[model samples]
Target: MSKENKHITVFEHESLRTDRGEQRLTNGQLEALQLFYGENGVPYYSLIHHGVRFNEYVGVIQVGKTVIEVLPKADKSNDADRWRNVLINMLHAVGIFDIHAPSNSNLRLRSNSILDLYFELFIKEVEYLLHRGLVKKYRKTEGNRTALKGSIQFAKHISQNLVHQERFYVRHTTYDKEHDIHAILYKALKLLSYINTNVQLNSRLGALLLDFPELYDIKITEALFDKIALDRKTEPYRNALEIAKLILLNYHPDVNRGTNNVLALMFDMNVLWEQFVYVSLRRHKANATSIAAQNTKNFWKPLSGYRSKMKPDIVLNKDTEDCVVLDTKWKNLNGYNPSPEDLRQMFVYMKYYGAKKVALVYPGSENRNQSGQYYDHSSQDSKHLSNEECSVISIGVEKDVKAWQKIIHENISNWCQLQEIV
Candidate 1:
């Protein structure tokens, strides 16, 4: 086949050609592209010895008749696995293979296939949300409210009135008339009024503001009301409310616009994990319970009088007996790994809570010499156990989610199996 025909076509909303070598995208840039293009439509393809084949569907950008194939920028072979994951995610979003399936089936596609083998593992999570009634249709109800008449159906109404407005704005307005200042100002004021009014009328935005009190902006609140009162055209009102909803849902307060400080990075990481990792884990029947240092304080008093409360990042429970403790640290584990103090604290939790496994999960960067066992000074003889003895594993957070889930699942399963054996 011809080179053009052999390569799978990928479409993007914007042009991709560049004269200055290759363009590299950061994680944040890749994420934005993924979100804007819809997580499901992008595609990833592989080239072997000049032959190209569609490896997996990453995401698609539908512009008229064109569809774009997208993959994370692959500067090296190691980046292939990560970019493949992005492709698998897009595939999952478009309803391909069921993410959650039993471990013993042909369902486990090879990790190298761009088809995530653990897709089945995520199905239980989606089902959980469905069972809980948390997921709902995107647009179930029509207008802003019952009283707004046709305002809720503003987009539809705009389609019908295109000709009338086209004539007034395009044809009637004088091309060279600089003195039509009054008309221009009137149009501007009308547009502003429409935005303010419609945003105020958006019940979804209002509900979001109420749900997340942190997102409440006084300027946004005031502008929404003003638009509702002044705008006669419905399109501006509808557009404004749409923008408001996007802001309310995605806005993160902790991110400093400039520097990538520890706090800002943590906030960004949390946001990404909340949407992609946490949500996916929850969908799979993985109970991600929050056990902050404060909430865990009462459980630790019998062990030590130490007033310090350290909240591990996440507690995964298959039940009371089958539990895995995880703490997410944004920093890399410099060869200094978890200190003797860190081991003691985790040991206390394992002993008190009867936790079978513990993990000090950190962002993957540097390699540390992990011996997989730590001493517990609390024991009379200073007993030492294999890391897997009580099941303590330090994993890298930067590993693919599938790998991370497998580690967690394997540990939890081993603990449960041990209980059965006993």
Candidate 2:
């Protein structure tokens, strides 16, 4: 496969080379990156620099026909499994996966194939849904003699041949285990079955195949999922449906499409990082104020009315006033100072929100081993408000949820001072 056709970036793996080394990004590729910059709630990206060195994220980003390859951070193993767990928890906190759904945090998928991991999560979820029994609906049934299961339509039967069989329109609610959901699952499974390249993928597919019935591989689309509905009785299927939806949505055939053409899938780490913090804070806040992500509000407006609105990442509201506005940056800001643009943006947030405190949070650099610091910028921003304070807080990414949860809780509580509860 041509380098342009297949761009590879794995978390912690050494960056791969294309025919041309470090080629300039195409206009389309830049546009794709921008689209990830915000359009969707999830932007999978970090800045190009971690400290002073270059550190791009991993994944294949597609814009037009061009593919942008980003390698993940080098660490002990790709730890893709662990990252997925992080993503799952993040998603759970963000309200994507069901809170009650079983998590695979304990199960680490031992494969480098992104497709394999995705397929594994998806198929397993489908099995769970199927095991719970596929949802059933009542539809009009005609023809077939002997069961007399539903109400017979005598009028239409009289128009047809003499009655040896009952011509009926009936409602049957039973788990037939055949539906569009299964059709989509079957189609995805069929795609997985043809792969011979990855042993893990092929083996996993083989194992899954035994469990799934021989269903026709039908053409599946997002609309297929839209057509199905889950009621209170089949509420358990929502989690599985979510998993299946992701798989089918991103499933693209790696057809080795000529040298220049490509098939790619990627996520913006920016969105992921923002959501991680916002949701975590919302989940475990010491204050009772409202926590909002990307709240829409204007900061500066001209007399002619060319509105310049500011969108802060996270805001904490008390009563009717904005108490704290926090902006999350996915950078290792252990020793570095905040950029002019960043400080300015936070200034706008504090000024507009009338917030007493604002924070610029970053991930602590791994090698630095430096403890997080608090720089009181209250005096610095006195021009805006003498009492206003801006702090730079860094928190380590803990492997344990409870530990991480505590870390997040303590860090937030440390920054906030709430009034006594009446």
Best prediction by TM-score: 2
Predicted candidate 2, C-alpha RMSD = 7.9
lDDT of 1: 0.35
Q: Candidate 2 on 82-105: residue-level lDDT in tens?
A: 655554555446554342335642
Model 2, runs deviating above 4 Å: 1-15, 19-108, 111-116, 139-175, 195-204, 216-218, 254-265, 287-289, 298-309, 319-322, 366-387, 419-422
Among all windows of 10 consecutive residues in model 1, the one with the lowest summed lDDT is: 258-267
lDDT of 1 at 43: 35
Worst 10 residues of 2 by lDDT: 46-55
- Model 1 per-residue lDDT tens digits across residues 340-406: 7766767766765567676554434322223366554556766664444333333333335566544
Model 1 segments more than 4 A misplaced: 1-218, 221-267, 270-310, 316-321, 330-336, 339-344, 362-371, 379-422
TM-score of each: 0.33, 0.64
lDDT of each: 0.35, 0.55
